[model samples]
Target chain A: MSRDENAAGRTMLEVDRLAKRLGEFSISNVSFTIDEGEYFVLLGASGTGKTVLLETLTGVIQPDSGRVVLAGRDITRERMQRRKLGIVFQDQALFPHMSVGRNIAYGPASSGMKRSDIEKLVESLASGMGIGHLLDRGPATLSSGEAQRSALARALAMGPDCLLLDEPLSSLDSGARVEIRTLLKKLNRGGMTMLHVTHDYEEAVALATKIGIMENGTVVQVDTPQRILTHPGSEFVARFVGIRNVYRGRLRRESDGTSLFESGSEAPFRLETLCEAIEGEATAVVRSEDVTLSAYRPDTSARNLFEGTVSEIVPARRGAEVTIDAGAMIVAMVTERSVEALGLERGNRVFASIKASAVRIIEG
Target chain B: MIISRIEPMHLIFAALGGALLLFIVAPLAGMFLNVGKAELSEAAADPEVTGSIRLTLLSSMGATLIAAIGAVPFAWILARKDFPFKRLVNGIVDLPIVIPHSAAGIALLGVLAPGTPVGSLGERLGVTFIGGIAGIMAAMAFVSIPFLVNAARDGFAAVPVRLEQAALNLGASPLRVFLTISVPMAWRSIISGLVLMWARGMSEFGAVLIIAYHPMITPVLIYERFGAFGLKYARPVTVLFVAVCLVFFLALRMIAGRRSHVEG
Candidate 1:
């Protein structure tokens, strides 16, 4: 089944409140679900419990609490071999002593498959992974990409129910990273349920159908990549998803059913927002691309408009990021064409326009 | 090639290292040079000498085979596990290597000799240990098993734990993982350890002499000849034994090295 077909499909792997403590780092109350064919990416930074969570799911590190249900079966305390979850580690961890063929055959052979069947299986897996010719070669002789392919084929030899990937692209060059990424996408499209953990947000955004953002061992938010980028659930998630302008302040509910976000203490400013939060401390996330900048207060119905001086204009990939210092600091992304047309520079007065709907408020 | 300038300090260090090397080689070279072809042939032809050499080889091989059955697993445990007093267990494994072989022999005798608990148990089982072939093997194993354990442990420790995990994830049982991944990856060190253990066992004299005086091994025979006769009588036998050991050691090393290359 394709990812779209499995969007509301059966849950292949359900990790509910899984908790584990390894030395000082801990994974606490982590929960998520992967559909039969959905590619789930657990995105977190270094020192987050991504690795620990993967280990717990793979049955390497037993969790202190919670259930890991695979295909409606509780596998929280199951043996790693019986869990039927194939894992590709960060290092790829191929058997150095075995040829690519033997490495791929290892899983099938272990489960008492016939010699002919194992040979056929190994051959098919090698050809499928584009490593058919490399089957006769040893792991040490293969390139990083080839080794990774061999590792993947070896993991898939047993036809696991779910594949777990731990930073599969962290060690690869950019070219190999893209190659493996395409391969992973192809594999997932072929009805393989995958739970890939990575610290790179770009990888998560590019590959994940749904991303779980982890913080301090707990999954803070689980949403689609677009939703995470457009409307982050927390300040950490906002900053992690590359939202440049984030402010922690108080949200006051107006009688008119609009919420006003008040930020900064010394030079406090309020931006009218359209969130359901009534009144409390909140985090206001305004995407840099959502904020428009002009030389003067142009005619517009933008609810949150302010006149400020452009304090910094740094060149970004798509355009220039213009940071303006009004009563509250605001960052806007203006293209190079706009920068030239508006004669935008440092210490220049400009009007930044943001609609009330552009402001997303999350409880702080 | 690039020629780098050498200083007086380099010369001094090189001379010291050369002296150490010369010290190790001088005695072996002198023995090889002193032995006459006629005398060497005579020693090799002697039934007593040949029988002793055969006995030594067989006993050492038997000891190595028996020790490896236990040592390899123990070594793997030592390599992979983290428990209380692990260092103490490691120290005890190496104790046989550090202690005097004669003292080791006496310790073995105390356990395996008649009237002791193990000795009485062996007596009940009709397995004589003292002054028997079993006693010789016991002595050899007591003094030489450490080499195998230490080498095998080093080999196992070098293997990344992730490979084992990867194998386990592939639905291999723990035993299958050990046999398929751990054993093959650590095969080189294990072979090297077995060879070292066998070589050490073959060269054991004081321990074997203390335990089994009858069915003399090559080392005990050499000592006997040296004590009964003189240097001239002992030199030929010693030279022949060394040559045999050198041949076997080199052959084993070449085989093990070639196999590891093939495996890699």
Candidate 2:
């Protein structure tokens, strides 16, 4: 792990082995860092302690152990105001008693900025968030999207060194989610370091410069989004990043410089792949989108092809999920048009083809 | 016609509740009706009655303001913190409301009497809490602090913890968050609490009677006038005091309502 290379840029936020025990839920030995200007996403499912970790970073929850270093200073014991970390919650949490403008102005005004300067700053931030028309409106009257923008403006008004977002887009509709996701990306491009937590894989992929997958109170994997999606470190991460087909297999090196992969003892089937063969038990991961479904096994240079029966077909977003039982269950995501054209359904015979490069191997 | 939707049993219950309302309103209305306009005017012109009314208003307001300084923080803690015996503390704060007012007076006098330790401490500080405005305010505050604390606690509880956290994240100190976010958000409840405490303190007789009988609050004056003369003489002062209370209470409520509306 190139820690020095990763630390080459100014580290904006570092959470080192932070642990907190809250009732039955606990954040155990969590550690991660965000470099300057990086949009780091902590990706996890519900009850995975993502919010707790974010709270710990913000000094809202005192960690029982470990340090939170922000901009090279340890802020584990510092008060939340002195730490200067801003957060936008999923519900937006706008002060209902305050107007939009006043809510945004709260930070600067409390810090003793001149009245005129606070007004100007509020105007600038509201306009920047596209909520200038809403400044005079009460927060209770704003729609969810409007509230989210106001919350963003309020957090940005503080000019915080880094922003912590706890599922900031989770409560928005699909349209609003896209809008805020774009806004987040735009903010990141403008050199604002962000630590965003979400359970949505699409959000992590769409916004993260670095992705950390958290599970059961600990970070299971941390890498770039593309790397994490393609080459997950563990089965939990492999499934979490939407790699639908995971098989425990034995890798046998063929004499022809190919690797023969066999999965399942009851009905063993072999797949040939053009990669370096390691002779050991391993877990093979293939993304649902990486598997191509065909009515017939056509002649192709693709190294792995399995003839199987479609056991279930479920409609998914913009596509259909077809689960194929080819000795081991494999899920393939195909377009709805493909599903119709191929006449795919439960109990239909199909061929699933995967390429050698698309097959990821995790050694045990 | 509006009663057409009501069931027979519900109508009976509503009639009973209405009778209870009448039982409370009749005496006050009868007293107001019995007091002639000339008698009310005479009572209003009397220096002692006016002075007592002024004392009642000022001392009650003073007690509320003084108690609020301590009670608001205590309420915030009760709402937000998880300390051992918190429920007990809450119940103790409410004990004054349940105990007899005369008993409260006895308890206050035991601590505030001239020879008591607290009285000695007050003497050293050049402040006395017996037969003085200080004693009257203390008695009023002792009976009324619960209203402010309990209501403020509920108000603080109703405020979302996340909103306070959001303010803190925006670089507001805890105290700043309390004042700017928590208190303002809970302003309606706190204002209602203050009004309730003030009104309760103004009407206090048994406690204030034991603590300070010389500086007569309106309730004591009404009692004294009733004892010395009869219903006719006391009714005019009662009507005047009740009218004053109703007017000021409504005004305060209007102010609170308007402020909340504007802030919202």
Best by lDDT: 1
lDDT of 1 by residue, A271-308 (tens): 99988764776677788989999897799999988999
DockQ of each: 0.68, 0.58
The native-contact fraction of candidate 2 is 0.89
Q: Which pairs of residues have clashing backbones in candidate 2? A: none
DockQ of candidate 1, scored on C-alphas against the true complex (2 decimals): 0.68
Candidate achieving the largest DockQ: 1
The i-RMS of every model, in angstroms, reads 0.9, 1.3
After superposition, candidate 1 runs with Cα above 4 Å error? A1-7, A244-292, A295-364, B1-3, B124-126
Candidate 1, residue B226: CA error in Å? 1.3
Off by over 4 Å in 2: A1-8, A244-364, B1-5, B121-128
Task: Place model 1 in a CAPRI quality band.
Answer: medium
- TM-score for chain A in each prediction: 0.70, 0.70
Q: Which run of 10 residues does model 1 chain A get worst, by summed lDDT?
A: A1-10
- For B134-155, candidate 2 gives per-residue lDDT tens digits of 9999999999999999899999
